[model samples]
Target chain A: MKKTKIILGIGALAIASFFMVAADHIDAPAVASGTADITDFYAFQAEDPNNVVFVANVQGLLSPSATASAAFDENVLIEFNIDTTGDNVEDLVLQAIPRDGRMYFFGPTIPGSVGVDSAIETNATQTSVAISAYGEAATATTNAGMKFFAGPRDDPFFMDFAQYGEIIAGNATGFNSPGVDTFKGTNVMSIVVEVPKTMVGGSGTINTWVEAKTKQ
Target chain B: MNNIKTILGAILISAFAFNCSSDDDSNNNEGSMSIEPDFSGTYTQQDQMGRPAVNTVFVSAASKNTFNVTTPDAQGAAFQPMFQANLEGLSPAFANPGDMNALMQTSADFTGLLATDVLNLSLDGETTFFNPATGALLTGRNLTDDVITIELLLIFGGEDFTENSQLSNDNVDANDKPFSASFPYLASAW
Candidate 1:
């Protein structure tokens, strides 16, 4: 028991260190440069207005030509954390994982457990959709009022990162009129989930975030 | 929206014909997958984020591991000072010569505000990164929020929000492609 506990602790720490190395776009340590890296997280009111959508984009900085064969890693799970009480603790979690050309989704329901660790919530309300292949028509699946999609999409984040770097380095004062889009023509593998507001604890204020976890 | 959905529906219908074997039995009956995912052990967090550029801008490379592992609840206490120092260092407009931005929050308070690093959303109101119409801040993010620009302005713009105009906007105004008008609204991959 003691040995097992120590091994688990070391494994958790190792995963934590690996997690720190991935944030937005290129510049991540080489080990995390692939699918494990998350580029952005966006949560907004869906067009239905009664539903909310959460998008967690990963593996950013892929050129158009390279995006053709890019795919989601089967081992990683992307989880969206929702905190309804403002305590910064997640009350509910919605997770997505890809397998055999489909992205499986589980839960906008209260997590049976929470924290740095997570279980697949295989028992929670679940859904799945075909993983939209690059250059193919997109595919989305709707189940039990929740919608799911996982696939590659044009990288939506636009930035003049080069100029911003210059400004931070004290070489430039401001950006030019039409700032160069450093991410132009790049793509990211995006996982999007839209759920009814009521399903996510409904009608007040909430704090949200995203994390990528690998299956142990 | 209708056109994309129609296209998607057709593709799904055709794809399902060829790949129906992949569907897990869980759809008709929950927890009944013949092959269950390996969820037995704890999967530790590798990375977390609530807002754009928070970790990349505030955390020095040396502190990336420490910063990434800490939870939002503990982030403020653990890294607020580091954020403040970095903010002041990167933006001279926020340091000795220029006053802090319009919020007038002290360095500690400012960093404290950002340290938690989770996006705040109000369910009852319009979801947006910031509502310029009402002057509200950080409610939720939109596809075209120009978040980096907003972050720069808040950190270096000072009391008038005009202290460092040059450093305020990044010049990239919108995504290269227009977002979809329906479910799963991200633009198509190039």
Candidate 2:
């Protein structure tokens, strides 16, 4: 196993005062520049009220030119952890990995083991979708009442980072009305899954998080 | 004009050929072990996220790697003090004695919840990231939802949402692109 040591950034700035504010875009230096960098995680009730959707966006701040070449690293796995029992430990996990040009998905099944390390649940129910290219129509796949998609998408996070920076530097006390959207034209490589509520197995509530792991 | 047509024809042929080959590969591997990808081995986590901005705004620069690798169940005990101290130090809304957020949580209580770092989604509710009008809080996050603004409100907007007028909202209210109304709703990339 190869471990990448990250050199922490400048220590002069008061860390607490500088809020990056755009979810995890300006993240810690370790995974900040790589495909493993997770920029945002969003879970929401689907259009069909009985279903829920989970989205994990990585490789943020991709420009139009960069997005065309951006690809989901085959060595990296994106996992969505669902803690149905409320203990904050994942009771179930949905893992997605890319092979060739398609994204393969596995599990809403019980994870064999959990935490910072993960083993792909090969035996779990699996499905896949061809990754959509930059200028093509989006593609999606469905199996066992679950739908999945993996591709580049316009970043949905809206933040006035410039104004926030001003506040941090004491140059401004408040954001101006209708502040500038700093992430206006950026993009992210997004992975989305929509699963039935019954499939998630929570007692009407669940604690979920997303993680990107590199194969060792 | 003939040269342009020849170029277009060549491009179309290559695209069609590429598509057919990939489709054949997928068909061949449909349910067989011959082409089944190897997924065995340990994958070490390098990055993680749950609730937007929780780890970003609270964990210090040096502690980020530690915070990312820490399990959510263990996060509170390990990082609550750091979160609480930062919240109290940075936000004026939490500075005053007995100050409480819109959730009616004190600095310590709020930080405690924030420290856990996992998004608490209600599987059977209005799924929103703090909708003031309907009083929905952290059920889930929607694409069009003004999350940063909402987060600012929770952090600096007092219990009744009338305090710290300047600090309470980011003023950027919506996504640059409108999301689709159906499955895989995120808009196509720019």
Candidate 3:
């Protein structure tokens, strides 16, 4: 398998950015329920206070039985896009892909190109962690102040999609308080990375996004 | 485009799987048959989303492909009209019989805000969805933020923000499991 590098960027600018939560559990037809489907992307301040954690969850809505046999596809690269200048253009990316039962990661490095296209950054810092198997202890690897984990995790996004559907169809007026979660029992393949804020961009506010780019 | 690619990839993967299974049986050897995995060439973007429910709420079923591949910068120009139309359909503000949506600002301004689908990270203050009660608005997402509720308010809630109290929140407020306090903090799978 060829090495796939992902670029992730974190900015520590003194400025503030608008907060938004974007998730799409609806897998479009082309990559519906396949390994490349990105159901949620989360970037938040870590508990350490000095670090930010980036979590990208794919292959959404898997059942307990289905997750036991599910695995990360080697050909698909999950890239975290970081835009430091507020241009919505990625300045750095962290790429993650699996190979030989291990998840290999590359970058937090600048890319040669950007936007809907990516190039492999072979010379960037590389780290590999054993892919945590289902029903086993959680495994994490840390190197140079960066921590990585790849495995199945509970789907964290809570949406009363059925109720929202009703509102959309004009059948209902509003959502019920303390609504039911349609994704209560499901799971998703998760890739988690925690890194120091200084390592990404240090002192500028950055816009971050995640992408599941399949190798051509 | 991604559907076609996935179908082709599936055929190739199944064929390769068959080859590997047959080779293992014939050789009676583990790792004897060389099954080189091909991860070469360029992988195209099949589906993309920056914010929750933007594609789901704004884009129609037929326009998903175009919406997915279009970059965030180009999105406002391409899909803002469609989003405006969809907004009119879903928002009760627009559906008030003879009265127009109270929040019906110019299509350009409203749609431009929704078009570029990137998550903003506040490097400084609280990272949250919308905290109108606290007066902090749209900073970035925390794991527990009621994002759908915020999106609904923005779409349906008018200028004074008191328009639709009933239709705004979905009520699913928290995650199924507690988030961890350490690295790789997502909860474990069931």
Among all windows of 10 consecutive residues in model 2 chain B, the one with the lowest summed lDDT is: B27-36
**TM-scores vs. true structure, each candidate:** 0.84, 0.87, 0.80
Q: Pick the candidate with the highest lDDT.
A: 2
- Candidate 2 per-residue lDDT, tens place, A51-129, comes to 9999999988888999999999999999999998889999999999999889999989999998998999999999989
Off by over 4 Å in 3: A1-22, B1-40, B94-108
Judge candidate 1 at residue B24 and give its lDDT: 42
- Candidate 2 docking band: medium
Candidate 2 lDDT over B1-190, as tens digits, reads 9999999999999988866665667556454323546678999999999988887778888999889889999999999999999998888889888999878999999999899999888987799887768988888888888888787877888887788878878888888999998989999999
Error of 1 at A59 (Å): 0.1
Q: In model 2, which runs have C-alpha deviations exceeding 4 angstroms?
A: A1-21, B1-34
Note the residue pairs that clash in candidate 2.
Answer: none
**Alpha-carbon local distance difference test for all models:** 0.80, 0.87, 0.75
lDDT of 3 at B126: 64
lDDT tens digits, residues A3-44, model 3? 222222123111111111126765455665678878887877
For candidate 1, the per-residue lDDT at B16 reads 80
How far in Å is the alpha carbon of B73 misplaced in model 2?
0.3
